[model samples]
Target: MNNSPIHILLAEDEPSLAMIVKESLETRGLKISLFADGKSALQGFTKGNYDLVVLDVMMPEMNGFEVAQEIRAQDEEIPIMFLTAKSQTDDVLKGFHVGGNDYIKKPFSMEELIVRIHNLLNRKKLQQSSEQFRIGEFIFNFPQQRLIYKNNEPVKLTHREAHLLYHLWNNKNKVLDRSYILQKLWGSDDFFSGRSMDVFITKLRKKLNQDPTIEILNVRGYGYKLIIPST
Candidate 1:
């Protein structure tokens, strides 16, 4: 939320699928480091501070389950998700056994993939020792869906509102493309999604009105921007 994007390490041998996934996540302001095989991906994970790791089951050098085992040994906290075509019971159990927090069968929609990633992240984030973000004078606890401002009653946020605010906070002081946001959050950038996004934005604006320095701007033909003046 402090202008640092969520860093993710992805191990995928399928070039087309990997490219599509990487670009999709990146469009949502995530930082993705892609590796073609398990060994390289494992190496990349060791060299990086990744918030999450996405592994493909079959690959040259090393397979995902094996890679996951190596990663689990080194860092037990980070979220690990498996991507594979195998829907067999044994493969599914093996993935979980190897420290995978979530699994998505191949031929999956981008929306499903994103949702699973968020679920894993939200679960893992709360499981960790700490997780907090600031918007003006307010403390936004995302996983709890609570927005606290001083001694006032906390404003409980809906699921969509929380996600919208999370994206806004991450890209604060910069324009967040409406289309990109719609696709990232609502899975489409159509008229209905745009209108829905607008309503959520309005609600966020009202809740954040306590701080005059904070503003969620409409960038005309482009998108929205959450402005926070430097203190």
Candidate 2:
């Protein structure tokens, strides 16, 4: 849609299908690099820069799940979408478990695929905008990964901690839905990632414990609320 091309990494073993998808997306102004195998896809991913990834689930040498996991291990925030013919719930769950941001079942319409990709990229942009947060006389600078107090004392935050806190502080005093948060931060709304988010929440609470006025409240089945007392 936009004249500015989005860099995309496409890992599909089927040449014809890959060509069709690549050409279709390219016509829409997306810049894509196609790989016929998962191994080559990952190798290219490691050596190149891409804004989004479309990985076929079944491939020789390596599978999409493994590749997604490896990518997540290095770049936690890159958007990843899985492409597979299988529509089984377990397979879909597995893709999300491996850090997939979204999944497209095979035989999908090109229109639908493009729409999903646009939505994912737009959502990522919105999240990035909310990375900076103001909370209880302190500013949480997510891009810098530091929390600065009024006195200018900066506290370094771990990757997960910074991301988790940024979301909470961005939605300060407002109820943030758990499912929305899990999907935005962890790239999935699965049980394990939910638990991991909980752990990060706890850690953030501890880190902010120094300022009793700043609190992270669990909304129980709903989500979390960050309470920043007004000075």
Candidate 3:
């Protein structure tokens, strides 16, 4: 996992700027996909896998805000960074309202962008580790990926699924950061992997649904929470 290269999706309309940013990030060994328009970027987002998304605010036919909204509908946890020349407070707030996690103004330095990306990724990684979790009548074995129910049946979990569950369970009563979960499970907070994680979470929810006391809650701007009924 540590050896895996981070994958990034860059949605910028300016061809020359996109190329420069893509090349700059690539030099750091990160995998980048460049899209010239919002439509193509959204389509690629649906079809391809990535770790993080870098979107330009002013784009043709479906601007970054619209694309972000669509992406959020499918995946509530992936990291989203907005890039735009608009510096007004209203514009920035609008980005956040549309589910943007971080914002970078246009004409920004490549070094600053790189640093911000690194910081966001690092922060995400720190939030995924959990000491233990109690789900319904089951106690999760984090390292082993097994759920031991009250009836003593041991439910096995896939590697990725287990990691996802661990993070949710660990954040039992709190908001679990979406970006952190993606980085922890898939090595990047990109669109595709984010969607994949959502699928895994749905499957996990179904498996645990048999226990009425267990529930996975979505916290809008934040992330997820695994609730355990009071004993």
Candidate 4:
């Protein structure tokens, strides 16, 4: 059994369900932080570094959608799952719109929940691994959160910068829609996040500018493209 467990943030109101789920996950080597209200959940989230978040849609003080939006504002990469009783199409749409990566309806089986959790974690791991790519004169290690330039020292990157660079590198030489990047990297394509992405792009450009053959071009009225010239 692996001891260094995955930490999960579980926001659910029902005491009985919360305890059961917590015990179930704990038995499987997962750690959980349970909150009965959305407000408390949000507060806890701000203070904790969780691997994934499981949110109940009908929590007190704030609904799952609102809490998800708030969380997405701070973190764009953390996987979010919605555990709610509501099964309406609109509700499902809202869940994903607010940054939910998975949605589990109520009356779910423990086995299924565990499987879903594992699947999400596995996908995230794969993504991180695939994100480590070689750009001209630079080797980006996304998991390590650094860019190694031509046998020189590794330049540490912030979480946002690393994530953004990963996305750009993943779609290298192709035009990446601006809104798509904002949503994928920042969890939202709103005005504030868009502005923030622009700033990050500028920073990344400066960092990668050391290599004359590499350029991140802004696609007029559309998106950005990371161009790596073949030597």
Instruction: Give the top-scoring candidate (TM-score).
Output: 2
Task: Name the lDDT value of residue 222 in candidate 1.
Answer: 92
Cα lDDT, all candidates? 0.83, 0.81, 0.77, 0.83
lDDT of 2 by residue, 1-231 (tens): 655678999999998999999999999888999999989999999999889999999999899999999998878778799898876766776776677777777899998788879867875676576566677777787766678877857887654566667667768789989999877655557765676677668878877777778888889989999998866
Off by over 4 Å in 2: 1-4, 85-98, 127-131, 136-139, 144-168, 177-224
Candidate 3 deviant stretches above 4 angstroms? 131-231
- Ranked by TM-score, top first: 2, 4, 3, 1
TM-score computed on alpha carbons, candidate 1? 0.56
How do all models score by TM-score? 0.56, 0.65, 0.57, 0.59
Residue 76 miss distance in model 2 (angstroms): 4.0
lDDT of 1: 0.83
Model 4 per-residue lDDT tens digits across residues 95-175: 766767767778999997888788668656855766567899999988767899988888876555776788788899999
Ranking by lDDT: 4, 1, 2, 3
Clashing pairs in 1: none
Clashing pairs in 3: 50-190, 51-189, 51-190, 52-190
Better-scoring candidate (lDDT), 1 or 3: 1
lDDT of 3: 0.77
**Model 1 C-alpha lDDT per residue in residues 109-201, reported as the tens digit of each score:** 999998878876775555343356888888988766679997899997654566778889889999999999877665457664566577679
User: Model 4's lDDT to the true fold?
Assistant: 0.83
Per-residue lDDT tens digits for candidate 3, residues 91-121, read 7656765766677777999998998788657
